[model samples]
Structure formats: C-alpha cells, structure tokens
Target: MQQDSTSKDSRIALGLALTVRHDGHGGVADDLADLAGLGAWLRAHPGTVPDTERYRADEPDLAAVRAVRAAARALFARAVRPGEPSPADAARLLPVPEALRCLNQAAARTPTVPVLDWADAGPVLRREPADDRADLAAALAHAVIGFLAGPDRPRLRACHAPRCVRYFLKEHPRQEWCKPSCGNRARVARHHERQKRTA
Candidate 1:
C-alpha cells in the first residue's frame, strides 16, 4: 500500500469529487442523483458525513451537494491546467471564478468551533461544526479545499483511457493511467490505432 500521511478529510475530498463516475456503458453516473442515493453515499462515509445513518435526506440537500460538486469539478479542471481535463465535465465546467465563489460559499455555510485536547501523542486541536449538525455541502467543500491546497495537489491526474472519466493521485514515478486496467485499455487502443494506420 502506498504510505501517505495526508489527512483523511483531504483524501475524502478526492472521494467527494469522484462521485461522478463513468458508467461502464459509455455514460456518466452520478451517485447523488436522488435522496436515496445521497443518503446511501453519506452513510457509506460514516464520520466524514456524520449523522447519516439515521439522517433524512431531502431534495434541497441533494441540489446543494450537486452544486458543490460542480464547483469542485471546475476547480479540479483548473488544478490540472495545461493538461486535458476529464472528458465527462470538460464541456460543462463552470468558469473558474464562478467555481471558486461557489466553493467558498459552501465552505462558509457552516460555522466551525475549534476544540483543544490532549491525547497520548500530544495536544491536538480540531474544529467542529457550530451546530453539531454538519452541512453536507460544506463538509464536502471543506474537504475539496483541503485536498486541492494540500501536498497531494501536484499528484492529481485525470485518466484518459477510452470512455474513462476519473481523477486519481499518481502513486509512483511510472504511473500513467488511473489503474492498470486503464493502462491495458490504452495499450489495446494504441495497438488498434497502429493496425488501422498500417492497414
């Protein structure tokens, strides 16, 4: 396993941005398409999106989160500048300034209170939502901010294999595509292209 000291929330930001994935059938799939889907996604990420086990999701919350996702995706496109962005959102990306405003607004939606404590390791400080009930959009936006501004920012990459629309952290020096399967697909596609040219 690749050892990384990145904070869980920062990693969670990448997860949040990846909620929109390429469906195997040449289309994009959104995990937050409905309240049920949103609820399930939240439940899957326990502590990061707290209170989701019994939490009731509504249309407004879903809409808000989708908006946050748009902003995150746009900023992700900016992060990979000079490189092609994920084809999934390439044509639909919001302007960088608008994306920035949207993300900032969502992040500020929830007020956080800092807490200080002593642990076995040492004194630690953390922040908690003021109301104790976290805003889904705010939490995700915060994570997006953390990941994009953290050390791993430079490692973010968009996979370009046929019909694949995903972003991943480049794990090693030789890494190219997001996964080995993507590499295989790319190589196969390249072979086909070479054959076509020769034929």
Candidate 2:
C-alpha cells in the first residue's frame, strides 16, 4: 500500500526493460552490453548515450525508445493505485492503457533467455547470426521483455540505492541491493558503525 502508484509502475516498466536486455552476451560483449546499456539509459532518462555503431541513434527509433520509457514509467504509476477508478478517472489518463498494453505484450512474449547461435567467426568464436546489428538489438530487447513477463516476475525489483536508477531480480527475498557492490558498500558502512559503537 505504501508503494506509490508511479513508483510501482516505474518498477514494473524498469523490470520489463531490464528483462529485454539479458541476452547472455556478457559484461563487455558488444551485443549483450548494448542492450544492457539501453536499459540503463532508459532509466536514466535524458542525456542517453545511443551508440550508433551498436543501436544506431537514428531519430525515429531513438524517439520510440524514449517514448517507451516514459510510457512505462507512467504505467507503473497507474498500476500501484489503491482502487478502481471512475469513468472520468479513466479519462484523465490516456497513455496508461497503451503503456499497459505494451508491457503486456512484452510480458506475453517474454522468454526465459535467448538461445545464442554461437557459430559466428568472431574472435570469441561464438556462433553468430546473419541478422544486422539493429535486428539483433531488437531481439535482445524482446528477449529481456519475455523473461520478465515469465514465471519469475516476483524476482524483479528496483535498485535499493536511493538515487541509483537500476533494476534487478532478487535472487533471494531478503536481497535489498541492485548489485553486490551496492550491498558490499552498505555492509562496509555498517562495519564502520559497529566499530565506532565498540570504540
């Protein structure tokens, strides 16, 4: 109940965005990281870095991504509301339905993870597909979406760090931070607190 409607929507949208990027590419791999970067950039909002070599910062597509993020955030806000709304209440929000539809579609197609071709001639020797970079990029996004909407929905969560804009799935219910580093940072701060108390 305490979760603000906007926050919930943002969390869900963020979850969807993150879901679309989990292509098993790796931390620094081009294909994988580009999708991940897009997810991060979406949450960050303005001043997004759209690498042309990777995702092509063309006007229409980039605008589409930005709009999607905005719609998603708005959708989350609407989703966490406490009750049913009147007809007039529905009239007040136009984009919510479309946004919800997008999320639903993303969720519906959300797969566990994409199967890699792994037959490419890259230095890494992974099989690569003949699809162009943009298609591959789209595939990454689609895959992320599918996984999030799948059976593992509950694991999705926003970053616990107040100002950080990131989303991650909790491996455990008690997990509070987005990344291990964030958790460790909190732990180290706590260690100093305990030390001061003992002293």
Candidate 3:
C-alpha cells in the first residue's frame, strides 16, 4: 500500500517536473505559461493534488506552480548525479540549494496531521490537512517531496533523448529513455552524430 502511494506521488511529481519540455525547436516550452495553460493542465490531470477539482487557479497560483516545477527540474538535474540532465533547460536551471529551499518552503506552507484511517484491511495512518483551505502548490510540493524521499528515488531519471525534456521512473533494469519514441530518437541522433564524425 505504501509503495503504491509512493509510486503515485512520484508520478505526480514527475508530471509536474515535465511541464517544462522541449519546444520542438531546440527551446524550452512551459505548460504553465499562463493561467489558461495552468487551468488546462489541471483539467488534463484532474484531482491529483489536494483540492484540485476546486482549484481556482489565479495568476499567483500559476506562478507558484511554475516555481515548483523549476525547482523540481533543478533537483532532478541534481538527482541523476554524474549523468547529464535534459539539455532543454540545462542553462537556466535553478541552483541546487535554491531548488531545495523552494521545494521545502512550498511543502511546509500547509500543515497536515497523521490521522488513523480505517480500511477494509486495517487502520492506517494518513496525513490529513489541518484546515479546509486548498493549497494546490503546497500539496504538489508534498507530492514531490514524497517522491524524492521514496524508495523509487534511485529509479528516477531525466530523459536525454533529443528534444525530450522529460523525467521518468525506470520501469525496468534496462530502461534508458522515457518512452520508445524517445529511445528511437536517441538512437537516430546517435547514428547521425556517428555518421557526421565519419564523414
């Protein structure tokens, strides 16, 4: 159960991080570029965060989520260690320390308490919000924190395929790129580079 929850949280966090992607023109694209874009994204992935269904995202909400995404991407770059991060945002990533502070602050914005949830199997301790207010940024930050600290952290990776600025959890031991299309692109790019060198 815990593993499942962790995986879900990781997926959500990765989803947030992936908002900044390659623009197909060797530049970065932001999915949360404006309130409309943020609203579209929220509608696309409904109910992932706390109070998402009721999330009345304003300008500030968009900015907050974008900040979280930037921090998440920066930390992702740091996570892969010696390996290269996605090239799309390489030059503009937030410093690792600042990213850490940003994520920490966002997560701490909302307070939660561990409450006993009775289930068919047994009673489980679940973190419940202290108040009724909806803090989408805080909830998303909490998901990112859970993912960063979960068991699958080691499997987290930033895809390096050409024009692919996405992060994914390795599904298998041999997994490299985030998707098959990315793998094909990477292979074709590598082949092209090799041919150029030989030429």
Best by TM-score: 1
Q: Which residue pairs show collisions in model 1?
A: none
lDDT of each: 0.82, 0.43, 0.83
Candidate 1, residues 72-153: lDDT per residue as tens digits? Answer: 8888888987788967668888899999999999999998899999999999999888897768888888888988888888
Residue-level error in angstroms, candidate 3, position 184: 2.2
lDDT of 2 by residue, 14-119 (tens): 5434432222332212211344555554454431222433444444444445445444444433442442222212332337778656545533332333445544
Ranking by lDDT: 3, 1, 2
78-125: candidate 3 lDDT, tens digit per residue: 888788887865888899999999999998888998899899999999
- Name the runs in model 1 displaced over 4 angstroms: 1-4, 118-124
Report the number of the highest-lDDT candidate: 3
